[model samples]
Target: METKNINIPAHGSNVLRADIPAEYKWHVQDIYADEAAWQAACAEFKALLPQLEALKGSITSAQGLYNALHLQDKMSQMLDKLYAYPRLQQDADNTDQHLQAIAGEAEALAAAFSSANSFIEPEMLGLGKEKVAAMLAELPELAEYKFYVENLLRITDHILSADKEAIFAQSRLATGTAASAFRSLVSADMEFPPITDGEGKPAIVSEGNYMLNMTSPDRELRKNSFRGLMGTYHKYRNTLATTLTGSARTAYFYASVHNYKDTLESCLAEDNIPTSLYDGLIQTVHDNFAPLHEYIQLKKDVLGYDEFHPYDLYMPLSKAADSFACTFPEACAKVEEALAPLGEDYIATLHKGLTEGWIDIYENKGKRSGAYSWGVYGVHPFVLLNYQQRYSSISTLAHEMGHALHSYYSSMNQTYVNSEYTIFCAEVASTTNENLLLEYTLQRANDEQKIYLLNQFLEAVRTTVYRQVQFAEFEKFIHGEITAGRSLQAEKLENYWLESNRQYYGPALTVDQELASEWSRIPHFYTPFYVYKYATGYSAATAFSSAILSGAPDAVEKYLGFLKAGGSDYSLNILKNAGVDLNTPQPVTVTLQKFA
Candidate 1:
């Protein structure tokens, strides 16, 4: 536990609203070098809009289609570059009007693409499945476009008419505007309680520091932080519930209007994911409930408690005690050292991420809650963290930087249209690096660090794989109710969530009444049954990490291929190409057995 005083509150907006934060945030001068340069690029980006719209209806035959695809590719590349500048800049400073202007530029870009995307899908659907198949089989250049088109057509049944599509497209921004605003406000504005330490109340507890507080061996501090945190949440629960409810209803409404069966199918269609993959993850977790129970039992044994509490779950077992004694700075240094096994290039990239301002280390006022890795095309991935120098904080660096590296590779190799991979596979890259970092630590670390590493690894799996699966199951359970013509009331939701928690944790632990209100606590449920990937991806990543560590030939090559593949292929098939099959229940089963 190498302790270092990081000026977190000064770290500013780095943690808050970073999804829209491009990592390579240039200054106003850096972007334009002066007003003239920014203006010129803005004008150039604007010009592409009219040109792209004209090409949409003009392309029907092979040559025309080829030209259109080329144009689309070029346009996308330019937009990626153009958008990266302002958004990245804005993310760094919320008060910058120029950055806000750049952010506002997205509306126009999105609106322009609406016409083009609506045109391409319907036109391809009109070409019929036969034409699409023949084109894919014949032309290598057209292979990616064909896959894109085929998937578009596959969801054609869910698509509305041209007029409706345009309306749908335009409304996309407005539809989620309030919810998007709420997400920003909630994460950015919600106040956290200040924490009291032995001497005095030193830390101004924020979401970032809350985790560290929960792990404090000091029981009063831990309970104070946890209770203070939940108390803050309690004050805003109604506002949050309404905001989230509106978001969920909007999601539900859009799927229904689009002729889709449900929000789950609609989300899967958006990324070309199969529903079977989603269901398979849920079903796999269902079968592995025993392992989850066993983990809880082990956790109880490790904590020396016959009855488990939520806070005790994160506490170190007997051996891990020594590891936490190291200061926070020591942990950061070790993170760099432990991650050295990822090849020279990968290590340098991680180092670059650390040294470069790619990471905005520490918490600050109005910063977003939690951790995330984000960057646009043609930029190094930047991660925003409200970091406390704990062992888990180092683990977080490993996890988030994994995502940054993955995006760095993918965006470098693929065009923007295909560059963005789906969330299903997103979890793997991050978790795989985490797994690697942990293994490296256990091998090289001192006894304290080893126990710390072990505890950290277990917690990572528990959170990413088991807990996420549990959340996924609960999410789906509620959606199932919606499917069965049931309404989701707050009381009913609380009951359902607590019931699910009871089942997951087993009858051994006391289920606190406050935990029943946990349904309102999770922001991911508003994402429409989206938590399962954390489970599935971690499972797949665990296997991938094990394989790579075994000195398997081409392991790195295949792993790199998986990162670079992006949305060029569906996530599952891409993972198969990389190695790890989620279709069989084995991946999750194997991950569970590791706990044994």
Candidate 2:
């Protein structure tokens, strides 16, 4: 594959989607050649819904069980393709009403399929464990489904009746209302006032450029941007608080219905993660805040500030290398070179993904913000990136490609039923790539570049591990409040936010009032109990990257095995097999020590 020089557009440019070169866009056509083919596939998928419904009561025998699961898997794979095509189209340019409507239709189709197949679990559980065991023993083909069947049996106490299960599945479409409204308010409706840029000129602030403004070398811009963004959220604080509370209430409702102890337990139950692990993470971080506080003090002293504030957190310590930039091709080459420890095949596949249509590489007007890697089972994973010519964008490229390759390796090695890994394990692959990239870059840097790179690395740890754990702690608090029958009012939420920041950053930083409203802007809060995984993932990645970089025997192979293991087993078992255990606080402790 030949690499070409692809020039990235200036930051904040408004180029239209059509203007982006074809070579830079992901090939959604690979999923379906055109919309006509997508319609045909959708029709065929709808036609097979009744076949799945027909097998509802016939799962008594091993052959019947295998047949039902096989049909479900087939339709699932089809639906995945059906869903990815239009969704990818819409993500490319959300301003297209036609694409949006079709994406909605695909989403509804997915919901309908989920509702139709809701009976399988209840019906399977209706067969006693003894009977299921007997059926498995009787049929050889059931070997593939042994884990799926046993997992359902394992959660037998939580499995509802067929009618209730179907109702629950249907309710999912409505249950997302809170999250949907939150997204609309933050992404579409909310607006930030213009702030002074580092150049003493007017600059607009939006969700996309807010971080860019925060990292500006100009102290006034960072301060104004922080206030402008958070002040906007503060204005809508009541509504935002209601939406967050609604989500927490919804989580509490589901946990109660499922007979779980709390929302945290219910959220972690899907992957069978222990609640102790979550609590231990917070405890470990609480015990090890010295390094984080020390870093804060170091930054404050280096910046020559009388006092550090929330806005001062992201400024780089080294000003000399502040203008560092790289083009898209340069970023890709750097990522590929940085990832060479994974051996020839991994690098070769990564090169293919970079050159081929697997990546949509530039930002366009109405294009989705941020970066992600997503794909259907049979297709190569596709990455969506608003590639900017900065070191952070290069790091993001490495992070997202890590996810893509994880999905790639998993799909290549595992059956469809087991190919999708849990969110718990997903971040480990991405952050491992990030750690490796940072290490590789640091090794080859000059003194000034080393200062810049070290600043970036420490800041990544501060935000990814320390700051995320702060968010996780607050998340747990809100959910616990709801579980204990309290309202998540705006004032209470703000107070907790302020206090948590104070505690996490310590005496070096002054927690501003505007910073209190920061919680309202985090979209992750809508997805309850999700942020801690970022911290844990970073810690686990630190462990894996350290071992691999140290030339530990079999480390690369074991890490690759973890990626390929996918959802074949529980998340903890997979990480444990790869030689990092999150059950103990050792990984988190070691990560903090590294930061120190």
Residue-pair clashes per prediction, in order, are 14, 0
Give the alpha carbon lDDT tens digit for every residue of 379-418 in model 1.
5676766666556777777788889888887887876667
Q: lDDT for each of the candidates?
A: 0.69, 0.86
- Superposed by TM-score, candidate 1 places the C-alpha of residue 273 at a distance from the truth, in angstroms, of 4.0
Q: Encode model 2's per-residue lDDT on 402-444: one tens digit a residue.
A: 9999999999999999899998988999999998998999888
Highest lDDT scorer: 2
Q: Backbone clash tally for model 1?
A: 14
lDDT comparing candidate 2 with the true structure: 0.86
**Best by the TM-score measure:** 2
